[model samples]
Target: MNLGRYIRRTAAHQPDAEAVVCGPVRLTYAELDDLSNRLATALRGLGLIRGDRVATLAANRAELVVTEVALYKAGLARAPINARLGATEVAHMLRESDARVLLTDAAHLETARVAAPGTAVKTVLGYDGPSELGPGYAETLDGTAAEPVEVDCAPDDAAVLHFTSGSTGKLKAAVQTYGNRLALLRKSVMSADTRIGPGCRQILAGPVTHASGMPLMGIFFAGGCAIVLPRWDAEEFLATVERERATHAFVVPTMVNTVLALPSARDHDLSSLRQLVYGAAPMSPQRIREAWELFGPVLSQGYGCGETTSGVLFLSTEDHRRAIEGEDEELLLSCGRPLAEAEVRIVDDAGAPVADGEIGEIVVRGPDVVPGYHNEPDLTAETFRDGWFHTGDLARRRSDGYVFIVDRKKDMIISGGFNIYAVEVESVLHQHPDVFEAAVVGVPDERWGEAVKAVVVPRDGAALDEAGLIEFCAERLARMKKPRSVDLVTALPHNPNGKIDRRAIRERYWAGAERRVH
Candidate 1:
């Protein structure tokens, strides 16, 4: 069934229930549904056909959410572009996706116009400004009739195309189906009644273009209230949580680190926060511990990629408690077991399962896993072999059934014939009292073929020299696993999704290389 049906159902069931909030502005389920239908009608008036691609370049806002639901209702594929992406990257995605209509707010009108010059986008609709299409672009559709349009979309038909970091190379759009999204919501509900709590308000700070924000659909599916933060600010986030009585929220590692570093962190009455989900990158155990101490056991972690539409492995509240009680460090480091319907395995080079504790390429098979990429048959063949999605991640399954991700299969550093996972070294560095965040990469070495380098961001008011940090790592890790060099920085660069920009880090060091070989 089409996802737009859910919006209609929710509106009928709870017409007056709070649906979405952007700062002070709010909309009920009935209002949101009607607005989306009117927007769909507007797109239809613009001569948009079924399966046409409509792209939105905006942050987390009520208007953006309205546009997405409208696209789905109008039978157009929704492609939400990352606003943090560079002009060249945005141009490439617009050209590659062959978007038929482009939508933007005042902030991104110039960028959107430049990115898709001479493209099939017949008109540009800007929110809340005088556009070429005139001033009616941002009107509320409250009184408009909700006329549902029928389109031929199977369960497996592509509903959204989410772009990956492209840190290894060019960005790849991971195709997500309606079936996959529904499966994710189903599994998430089974894992825990994520909707329970007084004042069930949720804050979304991550970019809506990513799967991190896509889970908000589940909140909507359950008829819960969502508060959207256009961009992340430590003070603003804390204030919103307290003022709105937000019970749930999720942010990436960097945002978590920033929030913890805020001087007034302890002063905020964040008691309303019941569940704090964090992922998209490996967070330091020390950082996690600090977060637990500050926020209580409400903090949890989820592990997945755009291919899975957000989370396949979820570290629940019980797991968080176990980790705090010192049950097992290995379990704490793991991304947790697969969801009920998801199957995860570690496989060898010959497509055979490896023994427990043996590292191999991680593979996952489930209804939630995407079947293939958009149009790249060769890459799809390489990624989805034998009906399983090869995650390109190296991991080992523990005796307790949890899986610990080592590193990207292509990111494993072989120095002096020793296999070194960058995460292991970075985790060790994170244990240092002065270190706030860390990323480790492999650089070319004449003697070892590849040498390990650690780039670190120190915590506020903490001083960490290279020697002290190296000594700290050497204490916990073996000589070969320790970083050969430690470079201290105020902060590491991050991609739009908030993961460390390792490619940007390596480019400076590997400029003359023919190719970047891990």
Candidate 2:
């Protein structure tokens, strides 16, 4: 099977249609088909064969999307690095993935140039123009013919080296096979709530190298427009939707929080939005309600990670309405049920299915699930076993199949012999009108072994104190689950993917301690 053929098919049907748009750059399907074809041919000309890895390190740009399609056409695996990653991590991933080619932009040129020397990277193509690294991206593709090159790949052929640092700050790649990626495309367009068709436009608001880029293939397969943002700005995102008449958008919770904080959010002409999907992190039920009010009844929550390729569970726009406007209020806390082609089960420690409403680790077995992490056999065996990938997210499966994420397995706080989930407490803290952001972490304690501590960022101009916040949580949460102490901060730390960094908050209180846990 080959994915590139779909691009050619779409181009044949609507060659003059806009395929991608970023700032002043717009590419018609004809241009997209030609560029990807030329680039794929050029890569083959570079002596790279099937399964060879190509890495990309750049900010959000149209070229990144082209590179992904080109990699697919050539039967090559892609390893995309987030631009925010430091040089050390960049070098580590380059070596880990054994990437043969590095395509980068001027902002990250120095890092790639410096890091590629000792690794398997043979060439570095700059996005802006030629540098000492190699020729410009356009120059490389220009040297090749635009004739189509579709490499036949097996279902198990390596397609993507999906890398993530996660909470531990260690980068690892999930070996996503061709079949897994094809499953992603199938599921993306199968659901009416998320399907992108002709005359539809999607704004990729985050870094296209990761979560935001997941929809590109589905959009292309259905002949839709992908409007990529050159950079992320909350107001610009809203304005682009108004200007481009974008029908769909995918953003993380941090971006949503920023957009909701804008005083002029209501001033923008945001009526054209049909589906505003948010994932990669959780947004509290309160924020979900606020978003529904502001963005209308078009909010979807996706739950999955790199190992799962993309979202396996999606809380559709209708699910949001059922929770907010209808009687199923508890559904607001759920991440929703499994989508097509994915089998999701909440299992106990022994790898057996847990009873309904009992918390367990989520295990998924499906075409979209990556086989295992690259070069980490031990970890691979630990996470992917008995044909199911064990997601370390602790969640409870409702009888209706909705999954409620309680906490990351490692983030659960055992204080005074009672297990307290940080997310449960954070969910309560989010209910307070004055709280803008909150992170719950287990801190060292003399008697309780671990005490629940909360770090909060209050709303602008809203008066709040540690005592008041603690009292608020105590009113809603059980006494043992409520925060024993609170620290008021202007902002909570965030990892690269824009989720609140709970690990960083716990580090401050655990410094110089004998063990991480009390």
Candidate 3:
């Protein structure tokens, strides 16, 4: 089934149900569908044809959702540009994707115009506000028909060309198919009986352009209400949760850490949040325990990459219970088991399966896995060897079958002929009572090829010196695993998706290096 079909089905079955709530604006399923139909008609009038690409450069608003639905309904693929990207990066993506039209608001109009100067973008639609482009956004369907255009879309048709964060290097577009998206939604619905129902509120706080936004479609598929936040704020997130009575919400580890640090967290009434899913980065066991204490046992974890439609593995509620009860320390470090219709395995460098309790590259295969990258054939072939997508993550599988991620292939540090996983060091550092967040990276060393460095953010008003932190890590970890230097900061840099920007941190140390990986 097509991704656009979700919107149509929900609109038809629950026409009056609240589909989206952004700030003061709220749209019913019927309204959302009709508005998308109008946008589709407008796009067609601008000479957009089947298979043409349309790009959106907006925040998490109703317009962004409408643009995606309209483009899909008209048999056009939609590319949602990350609002945090620079002009040159945005332009490169537009040119690479061959976007035929751009839908942007006043906030990003100049950036969009500068990016695609003379590309295939023939028409640009602005949001409803004053801008240099003229008065405001215009409706192309004043009295036009609201019926959806009948365009043929197969499961193999490219539905989305989403760009990755480019942490390794230049951003690459991941081609998503109708089948992949359908598989994700189907899995989400059947995973748990706590399905989103009519008027069930969902909070959208993460970047809508990222994979985190994919699950929001599942809420739409289940005829639920989505509360969109333009950006995430600690207090605002809590307020929205309380005011909207949101049932489901997704946030990265950084966001959760920020919310927990808020002084008002204890004062806010957040009883409405039922399922709080956290991923996109590793969550410290200490932080998880504190969150469980505050938010109860409703927190869950999802693990996946952009290459996968969204989530391939789910750390279920029962797993959280096991962790809370101190059943196993390894379970807390795991990203949990694979979801239904997914297969996960750890393989060695030669693609041979590794034995349990051994570390190797994590490979996944499933219906939600994308066929390949958009245009990088060589990269696609290299990544999809032997019918499994190599995740570039080092992981070890316990005898119990739960996978524990060691570190990224590039993030591993070798010092004095000893291998060190940054995650292992960071996990130990976070166990300290004074440390709020920590990131471990390798830096140049004279005696050793590399030395482990810990960048930490201390708990508010808590005093943590470098010597004390080193001593704390040394108490629990081996001498070689201890950090050589500790850098304390108020907050760690984060990417648009809210994950710690390890690339940025590495670049500071390896500015002139030829290779990023040590």
Would you estimate the TM-scores of all the predictions?
Answer: 0.96, 0.99, 0.96
Predicted structure with the largest lDDT when compared to the true one:
2
Q: Order of candidates by TM-score, top first?
A: 2, 3, 1
**How far off is residue 380 in model 3, in Å?**
1.3
| Ten contiguous residues with the weakest lDDT in model 3 | 130-139
lDDT of 3 by residue, 411-473 (tens): 999999999999999999878888888999998877887899999999989999999999899
Give the true-structure RMSD of model 2. 1.0
Write down the lDDT that model 1 would get: 0.80
Model 1 agreement with the true structure over 1-518: per-residue lDDT tens digits: 66777788888988998888887679998888888888888788777877778877777778888877777677778777888777678887777677877777777777876777766666677776657543335653443456765455677877788878777678878888878877877775676724442237788888776755676667777788778887889899999998888889978888888888888999889898889988889988888898998888898788889887778887877887888798765567988887768888899987899999999988989899998887789999999999899998999998878888999877788899999999889888888888888989899888898899999888888988888878788889898898889888887888878889887887777889875674
Q: Please give the clash total of every predicted structure, in order.
A: 0, 0, 0
lDDT order, best first, reads 2, 3, 1
Error of 1 at 444 (Å): 2.1
| Model 3 alpha-carbon miss at residue 74, Å | 1.6
C-alpha-based local distance difference test score of model 3: 0.83
